[model samples]
Target: MTISAAFSNALSGLTASGRASGVISDNIANALTPGYAKRSLELTSNATAGQGVRVLGVVRRTDPVLTDNRRSAEAMSLNADNLARFHADFGALIGPSDNPGSLTNRVAELEASLITAASNPSAPSRLDATVNAASDLAQSIRSAGTGLRDLRTRADRTIGQQIDNLNGTLQDIEALNARIRRVQLSGADTASLLDQRQQLVDQVNTIIPVKIAARDHSGIALYSEGGAILLDGSAATLSFTTAASAEPHMTQANGLLSGLEINGMAIRTEGGASPIRGGTLAANFQIRDELAVEAQQNLDALARDLIDRFADPAVDPTLAAADPGLFTDAGAAFLPADEVGLSNRLELNAAVDPSQGGNSWRLRDGLNAAGPGAQGDAALLKAMSAALTDPRALASGNLGTGVMTAGGAATAMLSITSQASAETEQRASFAAATFTEFQRIEQEIGVDTDAELQSLMQIEQAYAANARVLEVVGTLMDTLLRI
Candidate 1:
C-alpha cells in the first residue's frame, strides 16, 4: 500500500479511537445519573475502494420496554404510597381500639362512670364523675370529626399542588418536543434532549400514569391508561380550586368542593374509571371526596345513635319528644336531616352541665325536672346505667344490626377503619416491591462504570496502536526520500 493511503488509514483509526474514548469517559461520568442512558460509539469501514474507516457518530442505548415497565411500576407505587399515607393519618386520628384514648376506650369509660354513679346515685361526686365522663366522650368524637375535616382540607390542597406540577411538566415537555424536532431536522444528535424529555414524561406518569406515542420529528404524545390524552399537539391544562377548609357538609356532589378539569373539559377525577387513575393525583382526590366523606358519615351516625338512646322518654321521664337528650347535638335537639355534621356538633346537655349553669344532680333526677324530687334516689341513675347496655339496631350508620350498644358501635367503626388501613398498607408494600424490581432491571441496563473503564482501556490501546502506525508511516516516507 502507498504511504499516503497508510497514513490516511492510521489517521482514521486514531480519530475513531479518540471518539470512542470520549464516549467511554462520558459513560463513566454519568454512571449514576438518573435518566441518563449509556452512549455507544459506532465505527464502520469506508465504502470507497481503498478507504480506511469512519466514525458513525454516537448512539444512546436504552431498553425502551424496560423503561416503560419501570415507569408503570413507579406510578403504581406512588399511587399506593399516597393512599397508605392517608390511611395512616386517619388511623392515628381514631387510634387503635386497644388504645386507652381510643374511641372504644372512651365509650367504655363513659359506661363505667354510669355504673359507678348508679352504685351511689345521690353522691354528688359520683354524679359529677358520670357527667364528666359523658362530656369527655362527646369532646373525643368532636376532636375526631375536626381531625377528619382537616385531613380533607390538606388533601384538597395537595391535589392542587400535584395538578400544578403536572401542568408545568406538560408545558416543558411541549417545549422540549419542539427543541428535539429542531435538532433532528438539523441532523444533530437529539439524544440529550430525549433524556430530558423522558424525565419530564416520567414525572407526568407518576401523576397520571401515561404511555408515550411516537410523533413526527422525534416528538412524542402522551396518553393516560384511562384513555385521556395528556399531550397530542400541545400540553393540556389541568385546573383545580383549593378550598380554605373542608367540612362534613361540603362535598363535590353538592358542588362545595372542586373537581379537576383538563383543557376546559371536565373529567372524572376519582376511581379506576377516572381519566387520571392509578397515580398520586387520584389518591389525593379519593381521600378528599370519598374516604374522608364516608368516615364523617359513620361518625355522625355513631353520634346520632348515642343521642337517640338517651332521647327516649322511657329512659328520661322528664324529657319531652322535642327536647334534646343528655348527649345533645350542638347543645340542641338532633334532627335526622341535619345529621351531616353531628359528630362535630355533639356536646353534653347544657342543662346538666354545671359549667353551663346547671347541676350534676340533674343526672340522678331528669334533665327537665322542675325541682329535685328525691336527693337519695338511685332509680334514675340505674336506668341511665342500663341505657348503655341496651341493644338496638342502629339508625344511620351502615354498621349491621349485630352491634347492640353505644360502645359496640364505636368498636365497629374503629374495626372497619383499621381493616381498611391494613389492606391499603399491604397494597403499598406490594407496589413498592414491584417498582423496586423494575428499577433494578433498568439499572442493570444503565451506565456501568466497570464496563466503561474496561472499554476505556481498549480505547487507549487502539489509540496507541494507531499512533505507532502513523509513526511507522512517517519513518517509511523519510527513508524513501533519503533513497
Candidate 2:
C-alpha cells in the first residue's frame, strides 16, 4: 500500500483500539453491579470504498429467558414468604409457648378449672372457678385477635408506604424515560441513561414482576402480564390508592389522564380493588388480607362461640334447671358487611347453652347417649366433652362445622394453627434458600473484579501496540523528511 494509505489504515486501527479501551473501562467500572451483564463493543471494517473501522454499538450479553424465569421465581418466593409469616403468627396462638401465659397453657388451665367444677358441682367457688376459666379462655382469644389485628394494621401501613414509594419511583422513571428519549433522538450516547433506566426497572421488579419492551422515540414500555401498562415512554403512567378504614379493598389503575384502570376496570382514590399479583405487593397484600384477617376471624369466632354456648342454663330429666351455660353474650362479627356469608356462616355455636331446663334432658344426639335420656346435667357435660373432641366443629371461614364438641375444640384450634405456622416457616426457609442461590448466580453473571482486571490488561496491551504504531509512523515520516 502507499504511505498515505498505510497511515490511514493505522489511524483507523488506533480509533478502533481507542473504542475498545472505552468498552473495557466501562466493564471495569460496573463490575460490581448486580444483574449487570457484560458489555462488548461491536467493530466492523469499513473496507468497501476506503479503509477504516466502525463502532457498531455496545451490546450486552444477557439471557432474557433466564431473566424472565428469575423474575417468576422471585414472585413465587415472595408469595411463599407471606404464607410463611402468616403461619408463624398463627402458630404462636396454637403452638406451645415457653411463656406460662401462652394461649394453650391458658386453655389447659381453663380445662383444669372445669374438671374442678365437675368434682364439686354444688360449690359456689367451684362454679366461680369454671366461670373464671371461661373468662381466661376469652382473654386468650382476645389477645390472639388483638395481635392479628395489629399485624394487619402494620401490614396496611407498610403497603401504603410502599405504594407511595412506588408512585415516586414510577414518576422518576417517567422522567428518565423522557431523558432517554431525548438523548436517543439527538443521537447522543444514551448508554448511561439506559443503565439508569434498567436500575429503576430492576427495583420495580422486586416490588412486582413486569414485562419491558421498546417504545416509540427510543423510549421503553413496561407492562404487567395482565396487560396493565405501567409506563410507556411519556405517554402513560399507573397509579394506586389505599382504602379508607371501612373499605375492604384499595383501588388501582393505569394511564396519566382520563383516570386509570386495573384489569380493565376504572379505579379512584377512594377504596379500590386490590392490585397485586406475584411481587412484594402480593406478599404484603396476602399478609394484610388473608393471614391477618383469617387469624382474627378464627379467634373472634372462638370467643363468640364460647359466649353463646355458655349463656343458657341446663335442666335435669325432671325439667328442673341445673347447670348453667358458660357465657352470657357472644361477640360481634369480625368481618365487614361486604364479606358475603360472613355473618350467618361464620357464627360461633348454637348448641352451646344446655339450659332449656331439664327433663331438659333433651339430650342432643352427640351429647346424650340414650338420645334425649333424662340424665340431665350429666348428659349435658358428656355432650360438651363429645363436642370438644370432634375436630370438625371448629369453624374455619365457610369451610366446615366448628370443632366445638367438649372433647378437645381448644386443642384442635391449636393444632390447625400449629400446622399453618409450620407451613409458613418452611416456605420462608425455601425462599431464603432460593434467594441465596439467586445471589450466587447473579454474582457469577455480574461484575467480577479479577476478571475485569484481566480484561483491562488486554486493553492496555492493545493501546500500547496502537501507540507504538503511531510512534513508528512518526519516526518513518521524520526519516523521509530528513532525506
Candidate 3:
C-alpha cells in the first residue's frame, strides 16, 4: 500500500475504534436505566485501496417478539390484579364468615338476640339487645351496599384518568415519531429517540394494550389488540365522563352513566366484545360496571329476603296489613320495584328502634302493638325469631335457590363474593408469574456490563493497533524524507 493510503486506513481504524469504545461506555453506563436499549456502532469495511472503516450510525438492539410478549403479559397481569382487588375489596365490605363484624356474623347475632329476647320477653335489657342487633345487621348490609357504589364511583374516576393518560401518551408517541423520522432523514442515529418512543409505547400498553406496526423512517403505528387504530398519522381521542357518585339505579344502559367513546363513537367496554379488554382501563370498567353492580345486586337480594321475611302479616299480626315488620325499607314496606337499592336503604323498623324514640317492649309485642300492651308475652318475639330462620326461595341476585333463610342468604352472598375473589387472585398469580418470566428474559438479554467491558477491551486493542500503524507509517515517511 502507498504511504498516504496506509496512513488514511490507520486514522479511519482509530476513529472507528474510538466510536466503538463510546458505544461500549454507553452500554455500561445505562445498564440499569429503564427503557434504555443496548447500543452497537454500525461499521462497514472501506477496503478500496485500504481506506479503512466507515461508521454508519449507532443501532439499538432489542428483541421485538420478546418485547411484544412481555407487554401482553404485563397487560394481562394488571387486568387480573385489578379484578382481584375489586372482588377482595367487596368481600371485605361484606365481612367474611370468620370475621366477627361480617354480614353473615351480624345476621347470626340478630337471630341469637331474637331467641334470647324471646326467652325473657319482659326484660328491657334483652329486648334492647335484640333491637340493637337488628340495627347492627341493617347497618352492615347498608354500609356494604354503599361501599359498592363508592367502588363504582372510584373506578369510574380511574377510568377517566387512564383515558387521559392514554390519550396523552399517544400524542407524545406521535410527536416522537416525527422527531425520529427527521433524524433518520438527516442520516443521524435515532437510537435515543427510539428508546424514548419505546418507553411511551410501554406506558400506552399498560393503559390500553396495543400492537405496534412498523412505519417508514423508524416511525411506528399503534393499534389495539382487537384492531382499533390508536395511532396512524395521528392519535385517536379517547373520552369518558366520570360520575360524581354511582347510584344503585344508575347505569350506562339506562343513560344515567357514561360509556367509553373513541373518536366520538360509543364503544363496548365490557364482556367479550370489547375492543380494549386486556389492560388497566378495561379492568376499571369491569369494576365500575360489572363486579360492583353484581355485588350490589346480591347484597340487595339479601336485604330483600330479610325485609320480606319479617314483613309477612302472619309474622307480626297485631297491626294492619300494611304495617312493616322488624325490618323495613327506609321506614316503609319494601316494594318489589324498589329492590334495586334495598340494601342501601335497609333499616330497622322505626317503631321498634329505640334510637328513633320507639319502645323496646314493642319487640315482645308487635311493630304496631298500640303502645306495647303485652309485657310478658313471648309469642311475638318467638314468632319473629322463627321468621328470621324461615325457609324462603329468593327471587333475585343469582344467589341460586340453595339458600333458605335470611341468614342463609347472607352466607350465600358472602361465599359467592369470597369465591370470586379467590379465583381472580389465582388468575392474577398465574398472569404475574408469566409476566415475571418474560420480563426476566428481556432483562437477561439487556445490557451486560461484563460483556461491555470485554467489548471495551477489544476496542482498546484495536485503538492500540491503529496507533502502532500510524507510528510505523510516520516513521517510514520520515526515513523516506531523510533519504
> Top model by TM-score, which number?
3
TM-scores for all candidates?
Answer: 0.96, 0.73, 0.97
lDDT value, residue 214 of candidate 2: 71
Estimate the lDDT of model 3.
0.89
Q: Please identify which of the two predictions, 1 or 3, would achieve the higher lDDT against the true structure.
A: 3
Give the distance in Å from residue 356's predicted Cα in candidate 3 to where it truly belongs: 1.4
Q: Sum up the clashes in candidate 2.
A: 35
lDDT of 2 by residue, 1-483 (tens): 766666776777777777777877787887776545677878788766476577777767666666666666676677677667767765675446555566666666656655655454445455455445555555566556556655665666666666666667777888988887788788776767777767777777777667878777657777754455677654243444444331212212222112234435653321123344666766666666566556555554554444334333332222213222433233232333333213222322223222222221222222222454332234444434333333445434422363444324555566777777777778778877886776567667765668777877886786677677778888889999999
- After superposition on all C-alphas, the RMSD of every candidate to the true structure, in Å, is 1.5, 8.2, 1.4
Residue 442 lDDT (model 1): 89
lDDT ranking from best to worst?
3, 1, 2
Evaluated at residue 64, the lDDT of candidate 2 is: 61
Q: Compute the lDDT of residue 247 as modeled in candidate 3.
A: 92
lDDT of 1: 0.88
Of candidate 1, the 10-residue stretch with the lowest lDDT total is: 396-405
Regions of model 1 farther than 4 Å from truth: 48-50
Question: How many angstroms is residue 442 displaced in model 2 relative to the true structure, after the best TM-score fit?
Answer: 5.0
Q: Runs in model 2 with CA error above 4 Å?
A: 93-99, 117-135, 233-275, 315-407, 424-443
